[model samples]
Every structure is written in C-alpha cells, then in structure tokens.
Target: MEEFNINSVQVILWKTMENLIEDDFKKFKNHLKVMKDVPLSKLEKADRDDTVELIVQTYTEEFAGKTVVNILKQMNLNQMANDLQEKVLKIELQPMLEKQKAFEDARRAYEQREEQIKTQAKYAEKQINKGYKKFDQALQDEVAAKIAALREEEEQKSQMMKEKIEKMNREISALSDTMRAIEEKMRSDDVTPPQF
Candidate 1:
C-alpha cells in the first residue's frame, strides 16, 4: 500500500465533515414544518436568532471535542486527532450545527402532536360507535313494542268477530224453530182453504 500524506488525510476528513454537516442542516430545515405547536411563519422568522441559541445549548464543547477526536482516531491520525480535539471548541462550529439542532427539536415536537391527535381521533370514533349502538338498540326496542301492541289489537278484533258470528247463528236457529211451529199450527187448523 502507498504511504498516505497527513495533509491529504486532513483535507479528506474536512470534506467529509462538511458534507455530513450540510446533509444534517438540510434535514433539520425540512423538519421545521413538523413543529405543529409553533407556527411555520413564526419559526421561519425566529430561526435566524433562535438557531444560534439552540446550537449553543445542544452542541456543547465536550460533545464536539469528543466527536472530532473519535473521527480522527477512526482514520488512524492519532497525533492530529489529539491536536484537533484541543483546538475544536464548540463555538467555532456553532454556525454549522445550529440549524441541525433546531430542526431536531421541531421534528420531535411535531411527532408528539401527531401522536396526540391520532389518539384523540381514535377516542372520538369509539364514542361515536358507542352512541350509534345505543341508538340502534333503542330503535329496535321501540319497533318491537309497536309490533306487540298491533298483534294484541288484532287478537282483540278476532275475538269480537267470533262473538258476533255466534250471536248471529243463535238468532237464525230461533227464527227457524218459530217458522216450523207456525207451519204446524196452520196444518192442524185447515178447515177450509182461504182464497188469496
């Protein structure tokens, strides 16, 4: 394997770091929309100033130093890694990290709001279904009650019709008996034929 120069290694590491920072910055910016509690217009306006503060708070000196040192060590540049770790204060990289941190905060807040909204929607759906079930049960009960009432009324009407038929039959039987008796009397009293 050809021997690698320290300067070339440093240049490659710097380019890699820059690319990573740029990618993270874009991702952070994209996540700003997810902060539902904070309006997009407000965040856009405040981002210029607020990002600096967020970066200061999130990317502390200790964190930055450790990360740079780790990267250098991974590349086998132990001497350069130690030198960079001492010189790489968080403030020097604050501008690069600011947008990335801000985006993360907004993304987290947005996700939380989304979950809460989902839970509320599910609860509302359950309540609506429960209400519908109650309404359906009440309607079914009402219909059943009406049908039972109609059946009782029909039974009463049928009973009345049967009573009327029985009464008519008795009257007809009595009339027939009277006619037979009258005919018998007429036959018994036949002395002379009456001319009509």
Candidate 2:
C-alpha cells in the first residue's frame, strides 16, 4: 500500500503492447472486438498506447492483465504472459479497499461515542436519584429540628433562643451552598434531572 504510481503500471501495460507484432496486435484486437464492452471502432483505430489506455478505461488493470496474459499464452508467449500476470495486482482495487477501511474506522469511533453517552447517562441518572433521596431526608430532618428548636426556645432562656437562631441561619446558608454545588456537578456531567 505504499506508492501506487499508476504511471508505473501503465508503463508495464505499454511494455506488453510493445511486444506485439502486426499479426499479434491484429489477433489482440480481434479478441477484444469480440468482447461486447470493448468499443469496436476505437479498437480498430487504436495503436499500442491507445489500445492499452482504452483497455484500462474499459476494464480494470486486473481484467486487462488477464486478457493480455491469455492472448500472449495463445500466441505461445508463455514467459511474457507470466510476467504480465506478476505485475497485475490492479491498482483500481486499492482505493476501494482504503475506503472500506476508513468506513470501518468511522463506524468504530461512532460506536465508542454511543457507548460513552450511555455510560454517562446511567451515572447522571444515579446521581439524580441520590440527590432526590438526600433532599427528602434533609427535608424531614429540617422540619424535625425546627420543631425541636421551637419547643426548646419556649422552655429555655432568651439568650439560648438567640444562639439557636444564629445556628439556624448558618444551617440555611450551608444548605444554599450545597444546592449550588449539586447544580454545578449536574451541569458538568451534562445531565437532565430525572423525572419523578
């Protein structure tokens, strides 16, 4: 898969064309003319280079190579036919192969991203459920503490009520800070809070 150098392959095809004598070339054309795909008028007027180019245009190098090999073999030029076969890997197939590889790589990356999204969604949902439970418990505790504090305030000194009020103010501030932190974490995770 290094340098394709189509010119090199063309040179090889041209070389085969160069080996053809007048009768051999005529025989070559006769065979090609029979193939419905090969343009009959073009083959008649085509010299060696044009014939090679036309063959390449009509079919791939692989098919052209096969045809050349078969013609040469029929002409009793086995060595030349074998040599052409050796060079006939067909450069046209390489691009299709490369495209296939690129498509596979893209598909794999897409699947990985999809899997990561699923994992993050699961984690975010878990965090939302945890947050809901924590808030429910915190709500119950806050009400219970407030009721307890009210009872104590009625039974206890005025100075003690002032202290409890300050402590309650601090608890409220702490709750606000906790809510902000949770919101920031959800934003970072890019999660929608789960519905009840």
Candidate 3:
C-alpha cells in the first residue's frame, strides 16, 4: 500500500494564487470557494501563493476599517485551502498522471508487438518460399534420374538384341557352306563307282 501525502494541495494553491494580480483576490476567493470540498492535503502542492500574499498584504495594510482585517482573514483561509490541495495532489492528481503514463506505455507495447508479428510473418513467408523452391528442385532431380535410368535400360536391351541377330546370321552362313561341300563329295563318289 502506498502512503498518500497530504500537503501537495496547499502548495499548488499557493502557486496558483501567486501568479494572479492583487485585484483578482475576490475572483481568486471565488475560485477557491469552488474547490471548497477538495481536501487541503490534496492541494498541499497546489499554488496558494496568491492567497498567501493576499492575506499577508491585506493584514499588514493600514486600512479604513475592519475590512482590512476581513481581507487578511481570507488569506488565512487559504492556509486551510492549501492543506487540502496538497492532499489531493498526492492522492488524486499524481496517481491520475501515473495511470495516464501507464496507458501510454501499454499502447506503445501493443504497437511494438504488432510490428514484431508483422516481421515474423514476413520471415515465415520467405522461409516457405525458400522451402518450396528446394522441394521443387528435388522433385525435378528425382524425375531426371528416373528418366536417365529408363533410357540406360533401353539402350542395353537394344545392344543385346543387335548382338544376338549378328551371331545367328553368321551361324547360318557356315551351315550352308558345309552342306554344299558334302553334296559335291557325294556326287564325285557316284561318278567313280564303275572303276570300283
């Protein structure tokens, strides 16, 4: 629990009153009247200099009648007003200001988070594209390999068929020559049969 300070309102009142002209004391009193319910401790930090000076000056003056003392009394009343203003400053205004600051901070945090999400999304997209490219290249490589293997197998089969055909042709030509030689020999033997 934070302990609340009670004298800030008085200080504030004094400061506010200090800046005003002497003739404005009556108006200043009206302003103070409006703030009658505000705690003096809250207004401790408030400007009461105006009221203070008015009181001191009025009291010190050699006036025509009891009016002088009465004016001085108004300045005394400022003392009480100041006390409440101080309290309000510490308990109310300060906390309000701090809350405002926190809200601003939260807003900034949200903005930063949004920016980070965007950055992450962009990075993810890049990675996805990169992965797709890699996958596509792998698929292409696989297809090329398969095609090459099929072509190699076809070439091997064609070469084997060609070799087999050439070998068959050579065997057939040798068989034909051998058969003609045998026929020639057999005819020669028959022609010589009467000499035997």
Candidate 4:
C-alpha cells in the first residue's frame, strides 16, 4: 500500500482545529485524551498544530485522519468535516503526485542537457585539434627554412675562402720571379766591377 503524506493531512486537521472557540478547543483536547492518555498538563499547553502533531504521533497518518474526522462529526462540525473529508483525498495525493511529476520533468531536462554538452564538446575538440595541427605544421616550415638559409650562408663563406687562397698564391709567385731577376743583376754587376 502506498504511504500517503502525513503532513498535508496534519495541516488540514490543524486548519479545522483553528475554527474552534476556546470551549470547543478544550472539548477537542479532552476528546483526544479519551483516544490516548497523556498528561493533561501537556494537552493544556499545546496549540492547534501541536494538537494535530500529537494525534498523528499517537496514531499513524491514516488512523489520525479518520480519528480527527470522527471527532469533528461528534462535535457537531459535520459541514466542516464534510468539507475537510473531500479535501483529505486531494491534499494527500496532490502534493506527492506533483512532486513525482516535477522529479520526472527534471530528469528529462537533465538528460537533454547532458546530450547537448556531449555534442558541443565533440565539435569543439575537432576544431581545436585542427588548429593545433596547423600550428605544428607552421613551426616545421619555419625551422626548415632557417636551416636551409644557414647552410647557404656557410657555402658562400667556403667559396669566398677559396678565392682568397688563389689570390695569395699569385702574389707569392710574382715575388719569387722578382727575387730571381735581382740575383742575376747582382752577379752581372760583380763581374763588371771597373770604376764606380
């Protein structure tokens, strides 16, 4: 059997209890004592909500609802009891039913949101990976260009050095020829000595 909500029924009873004058309230409290004995001093101090709570405590929710209704009818509050009895079914089912409905609605909304996030995340991941790949390719191109430029500069240096070596060899050859000519002239002068 489904456990109907007790608090809603308790509130209904409390509302009915509110209509009672002081004497009637006292009568109602006395009637509650007949149902279940507690300290009268405790009952005296208790207000409408407290009285309903006490009844619900003494008897469970179902028994308490019936008990309050019978007590009201006994007190010549038949119209109020009739009105309340009609509300009893509504109050018990409505709040709990609405709560279940709300829970189901929330569950559906959450599932839809989860799917939306998953779809969006996939698109985002693909775009980001493409961007990173492009960036990596750019870096590779830049590194390769720099390496080729440095190699070309080194080749130019080697070519310049070879040209300089050839020029130095020509200058050494011209000096050697001049030294031979001077030696030949000195020998001719020595052989011809005569007057200075």
Candidate 5:
C-alpha cells in the first residue's frame, strides 16, 4: 500500500488506542498497577509500538503475553484486530513496515548523493589547482623569457655604446695629430722666412 495509507492506518490505530484508554480505563482498572497514575492523554500521543506494548502488557498475564491484535480487539477494532490475528500477525502493519523500509532506502540514497557531491567537489578542486599551477608556470616562463630578452637588448646596447665611444676616441686622436702637424709646419715656415 501507499505510504499515506499506512500513515492513515497508524492514525486510526492511535485514535483507537486513545478511545480505549479514555472510555475503558475502568474495565482494565485491576490491570492498571504500573500505569495507574499515567495519563490517558499521554497514550493519545503514543507513536511507537513500545508505548502500546506498555499499555497491553499492563493487562496481559505476565506483562509480556499479549499480541498487538489482542490489544486492538480489546479496543473494539474488530476488523483490523481480526486481520492482524491471522497466521501473519503483522499483516495489518505491512504497509507501515514498507513505509519504514522506503524511508530507510531514501535515507541511504541521500547519503550516497551527499558523498558523490563531496567527491565531485574534491575532484573539481584538484582540477582547478592543476589548471592554476599550469597557468602560474606559464606566466613564470613568459616573464623569464621577457626578462632574458630585455637583458640581451641591454647587453647589445652596452656593446654599441662602447663601440661608439671607441670610434669617437680614435677620431679625436687623429684630429690632435693633424693639429700638431699644422703647428710644426707653421714653426718650420717661420724659421725659413719664405717669400710669398
């Protein structure tokens, strides 16, 4: 059956238990040794079988001797009571059990999805780090190449400057020699006192 139907049946069962506790408390008064002061209103809120079992045990022979079907019969839920009393005692609870199993399955699926998401996130992080590393290395390589180019250019400029300085020095030395030769010729002409 559908989960909603199971939920509805559970609601009906709880209601029946509530009604039994409210209307038939006096009938089971002798069996109310441990649950005498316990409020019937509390049973209205019972959600688990253990709580119902506590109520049933209070009336059973040894506080441990009753089935859920017997409890339902006592509460006048004859149809559901008989249905549960058949060879399969949990027949009436099949839907609820199936619902519980479905919930467990869904929980496992959710956990797996969460794990998958975490794994994907880790993989994405690794990929990003790898890409960044490659980018960083490429950047470093490009910078190094540019720096080497600049250094080579600077070295060429220094060599060109040195060559220009050497050429200028050679031109200055030649000019000085020419000036000395003119001065020596003038001195020789003055000594000779030549006519025009």
Candidate 6:
C-alpha cells in the first residue's frame, strides 16, 4: 500500500491539519472518502488488505489527541533546521571563496613581479654585454691606430736619415774634386809647393 497518494494530493491540506481531521466521525468519513478515491486500478489485488489497514490507522491516529500534531510540529522544525544548515554552509563558503580569490590574486601578482624582475635582469645583462663589446672594440681600434702611427713615424725617420747621408756624401765628393784640381794647377806651374 502507498503511505501517501499522489492522486489525492492537496497543496492546501499540508497547511492545516484541521482540514484532514475535525471530529471523530468526520475524520472517519474523510478517511473512507480518500480510500474510495484511491485508484484500485494502480494497486495489485494483493495490496488491498494492507491499504485498508493503513487508511484505518491514519484516521484513528489523526482524530485522536496530541501525537499527530506533535509529529507535524516536529516536521516543521526539521525543515527549519535544514534551512539553517544550508544558510550556514553558504555563509561559510562565501568567505572561503573570497580567501581563495585573494590567494589567487596574490599568486598572480607575485608571478608578474617575478617576470618583471627576470626581464630587468635580462636587459641589464644584455646592456653589460653590449658595453663590454663596445669597450673591447674601442680598445682594439686604439691599439691599431697607435701601431699605424708608430710605423708611419718610423718610415719618415728612415727617409730623413737616407737624405742626410746622401747630402754628406755629395759634400765630401766636391771637396775631393777641388783638391785634385788645385794639385794639377800647382804641378803645371812647376812652382814650389808653398808650406801652408
């Protein structure tokens, strides 16, 4: 037997117990009415006895004092408790979600800073390498220029020394020729060589 029937379901009935039970005979009559309305077509013939028994029990308990009312009150309180638990879970999760978001933001910020630092370091390294290359090139050019200048000065000095040597040889040759001429003249005249 079905403990509750969907066919006879009433949205308003759950709102008030008085609608289901008023006095003793009225309760009994309501139970019979609901029992007849219960679809026998859906029920197996074997379940008939059980269905009858359940209807009778429900009617008796509902019309009697205290117990059914207490049960209804307990169900309402249980509903309230479930609602409170859901609210608390939502409240607790809100802060946890916020904290998770904060942690994610902080992690992202740290990663960005790390990337920035890496970029700066790379740039600095590149600049240093550039400076070193430039310095190395400058030093090489300066040494090469000095070597070239020294070679040029050495060639100039060699040329000047050659010129000085040629001039001195010419002067010595002229002086030798003049002495020969004077000696010939003195011999032709047959004059005694004057003691100077």
How accurate locally, in lDDT, is each candidate? 0.57, 0.80, 0.57, 0.80, 0.59, 0.53
lDDT (tens digit, per residue) of candidate 5 on 1-196: 1222333334444544455544454433323333454356555454445454555434431222234445455656577656544523253456668889999999999999999999999999999999999999999999999999999999999999999999999898998787777777988777543343
Q: If both were scored by TM-score, which would come out higher, candidate 1 or candidate 2?
A: 2
Best TM-score among the predictions, by candidate number = 2
What does candidate 3's lDDT look like per residue over 1-196, in tens digits?
3332324433443554565565565554554445453344443443455445343333321221123223334666554455444444454457678889999999999999999999999999999999999999999999999999999998998889888888887777787677666667767776432222
Show where candidate 3 strays beyond 4 Å: 1-7, 13-94, 165-196
Query: What digit string (tens of lDDT, one per residue) describes model 6 on residues 44-108?
Result: 33132343334334443222212223333344544533433444344435557878999999999
Please tell me which predicted candidate would have the highest lDDT against the true structure: 2
List ranges where model 1 is wrong by over 4 Å: 1-93, 176-196
1-196 in candidate 4: lDDT tens per residue? 3455655777778888888888988888888877665466677789888888888776666667778778888888788778888888676678678999999999999999999999999999999999999999999999989988988988898888888887888777787677666667877776542332
Q: Kindly report which residue stretches of model 4 are placed more than 4 angstroms away from their true locations once superposed.
A: 1-91, 173-196
User: TM-scores, in order shown?
Assistant: 0.45, 0.49, 0.43, 0.44, 0.48, 0.41
Clashing pairs in 2: none
- Number of clashing residue pairs, candidate 2: 0
- Using TM-score as the yardstick, the better of models 2 and 4 is 2
Question: Rank order by TM-score, top first?
Answer: 2, 5, 1, 4, 3, 6
What TM-score would candidate 3 get against the native?
0.43
Per-model tally of clashing residue pairs: 0, 0, 56, 0, 0, 0
Model 3 collision count: 56
Worst 10 residues of 2 by lDDT: 1-10
Residue 30 lDDT (model 3): 57
Ranked by lDDT from best down, the candidates are 2, 4, 5, 1, 3, 6
